[model samples]
Target chain A: MRDTYQEQLDELASGLADMCDDVARAMARATTALLEADLQLAEQVISEDIKIDDVRAAAEHRAFGLLALQAPVATDLRVVVAAIHGAGDIERMGDLALHVAQAARRRHPQTVLPDEVKSYFAEMGRVGVELAEKAGRVIRTRDLDAANELEADDDAVDDIHQHMFTVLMDRNWTHGVSAAVDVALLARFYERYADHAVAVARRIVYVVTGQMPGPLAV
Target chain B: MRDTYQEQLDELASGLADMCDDVARAMARATTALLEADLQLAEQVISEDIKIDDVRAAAEHRAFGLLALQAPVATDLRVVVAAIHGAGDIERMGDLALHVAQAARRRHPQTVLPDEVKSYFAEMGRVGVELAEKAGRVIRTRDLDAANELEADDDAVDDIHQHMFTVLMDRNWTHGVSAAVDVALLARFYERYADHAVAVARRIVYVVTGQMPGPLAV
Candidate 1:
C-alpha cells in the first residue's frame, strides 16, 4: 500500500509537469498567431482555454486527493499550493495571449511599424516567450536559479514598456491615435506578461523560502 | 496556548478584512474623484499605493502562516486560499482606482454629457460600490447567496461600461484624441473594478461550493 501511494504521488507530479508543458506551448502558439496574423491559431488558443481550465481542475483534484489520503505535511503541502497558484497564473497568461490575438485581428495587416517600434516589440516578444519557457522549466525542475533569472528579465521588459509609452505620447511622431492605442495596449500586454513571469519567479521563491520573498524588482 | 493561537488567527483575519475595506473605499473614492475632478482625492489614492502594498503583503503572510501551521483541512483551507486570491484581485482593483484618478487629472473640469450621464454614473457607481461592499460581506459571513448577488450586480456595471463607451465614440462629442484616451481608460478602470468584484464573488462561491465556479459574464 505504501509503495502504491508513492507511485501515485509520482504520477501526479508527472501529470502536472505535462500540463505545464502544454500551457507553455499554447502561449507560444498564441504569440505566433499574433506575429503571423493567423486566424487558425487564434481560434486554437480560444478553444484551448477549456483544455487549460480542465488541466487546472485535474491538478487541483489530484493535489486534494493526495492531501486527503496521505495528509501531506510541510513542504509537500506548500508544493501543492504553489502548483495551484502557478496553474492559475499560467491560465491567465493564456487568456492574455487570446486577447492579443483578438486585438491583432483589428490591426492593420502586415506588421507595419516604425522600425524602432518593430524592433522593440520583437525583443519584448522574444523575452516574454523565453520567460514563459523558463517558467515551465522551473516547474519541472524546481530550479531556483532559473526563476531568479526571470526576475532580472522583467527590468528589460519594463524599459521597453516605458520607451513605448514615450513614443505614444511624443507630439513629433503624429502617431495615429488608434495606432498609439493598439501599440500601447500591446506593449502593456508584453510588460504585463513579463510581470506575470516575475510573479511565477516569486512563486518559486515562495516554494524555496517557505514564504513569498519580496517582489522580483531585484 | 490555544487562546494565543486563535488570537493570532483572528488578528490576521481582521487585518485582511481591513484591507478589503480599504480597497472597496478606494474604488468608490476614485469614481468620486473622476466625477468631481478632485485632485486631492486622486493624490490620496496614489499615495496609498504603498500602504495597499503593505496590506497585501501582510495579508498574504498571515494567510501563509495559517496554512503552514494549521494545515487547515478541507473548507477552512479553501477559505484562506480564497482570501489570498481575493486579496490579490482587490489589490489590482485598488491599482485601477489610481489609474482612474490619474486619468482624471487630464480631463476637462467637467464632463460634457447632458445631465443624464451624471445620473447614469451615480446609479452605476452605487451598483459597483455595492457589489464591492458585498465582497467583504462574503468574506465575513461566508454567504454564497450574497456572492451570487454581487455577480448579478456586475451585469449592471457592464451595462454602464457599454453605455459609456458608446457615448465616447459618438461623432457628436467634441472630445479630442486625449479625451478619447481618458474615456477608454476610465471605462477600463470601471470595468476592471467590476471584474475584481466578480472575482471575489467567484472565490466566495468556491469557498462554499468546494469547487471553483465558472466565469461570470462581465
Candidate 2:
C-alpha cells in the first residue's frame, strides 16, 4: 500500500508538472496573440482556460485521493499538498492570461507593440516557460539547487517587469485610454506570472527545507 | 498528549473565532462610516485596522503552530486549514473597509456620500454586516444551514451591486470623472466584502464535510 501511495504521489506530481508546462505555454501563446492581434490565438486561449481549470480540479482530486486512500505520511504528504498548491498557482496564472487576452480583444484586433516593451514581453514569456520547465525538473529530481535556481530566475522576470513599467510611465506615450489599459493589464499578467512561478519554487523549498523561502531568496 | 493537542486546538479556535468577530465588527463600522459620511467613525475604523491586522497575523501563526506541532491528520488537518483560510478572508474584508475609510477621509470633514446612492450604500452596509455576522455564527457552531444562508446573502449583495451600475450609468447625474471613480470604488468595496463573507461560509463547509463545497455552498 505504501509503495502504491508513493507511486500515486509521484504520478500526481508528474501530471501537475506537465500541466504547469502547458499553462506556461498557453500564457506565452496568449501574449503572442495579443501582440500580433491574432484573433484566432486570443480565442484559442479563452477556450484553453477550461484546460487549466480541468487540471486544477484534477490536481486537488488526486491529492485528496492520496490522502483518503493512502493516509500518506512524511514526504508523501508534503508532495500531495505541494501539488495542490502548485496547481492553484498555475490556475491563477492562467486566469491572468485570460484577463490580458480579454483586454486585448476588447481593444479590437491588435495594437502595435512598443519595441522595448515588446522585447520585454518576449523575454518575460521565455522566462515564464523556463520556470515551468524548471519546476518540472525540480519535481523529477527533488533537487534543492534546481528549485533555488528557479527562485532566483524570478528576479530576472522582475527586472524586466520594472523596465516594462518604466516604459509605461515614460512621458513618451500620451495617447489613448486603450493604450493605458493594455499596458496595465499586460503588467498585471507578467507580475502575476512571475508571482505564481515563484510560488511553485517556494513549495519545492518547503518540501526540502520545511520553510518557505522569502523574497530575499530571490 | 493527544488530549492536550485537542485542548490547544479548541483554545486556538475559540481565540481566533473571537478575532473574526472583531473583524466583522470593524467591517460593519467602516461600512456605516461610508454610508453616514461619518469622518470620526471612519477615522476610528482606520485606526482600528492595525488591531485587525495583529489578530490576522496571530491567528495565522497559531494555526501554523498547531499544524507544525500536532501534525494533525484528516479531520484535524482540515480544521486547521479552514481556520487559516478563514483568517485570511477576514483580513481581506478588513482591507476592503480600509479602502473605503481612506475614500471617506478624502471626502473629509463633510458628508460627501451622494444622496442619490445613500440608501444603496446603507443597504449594502446592512447586508454586508448581516452576512459577516452569520458567517461568524456558522463558524462558532459549525452549522451547515447557517453557512448555506451566506450564499443567499451574497446574492442579495450582488443584486444591490448590479443596481449600483444602473445608478452610475444613469446619464441624468451628468457627474464628472471623479464621481465615477468614487462610485466604482464604493461598489468594489461592497462586492469584495460580500466575497470574503462567502469565503468564510465556504470554509465552514470545508470543515464540516472534509471536502470542498460547490458554488452553491458559498
Tens digits of per-residue lDDT, candidate 1, B1-218, equal 35465565566556656666787787777777777877777778778877888787787777767776776677766777777777777777778777776665555366422343566666666777777778777777778888778767887888887787576556665544455555555665677788888887788788788866785322
Residue pairs in candidate 1 whose N, alpha carbon or C atoms collide under 3 angstroms: none
For model 1, the local distance difference test gives 0.69
lDDT of 2 at A165: 52
Give model 2's DockQ, 2 decimals.
0.16
Residue A130's lDDT within candidate 2 is: 81
lDDT of 2 by residue, B143-200 (tens): 9998888888888888988787666656575544345446655775787788778877
The candidate scoring highest on DockQ is 1
- Per-model TM values vs. the true structure: 0.84, 0.71
How far residue A214's Cα lies from its native spot in candidate 1, in Å, is 2.1
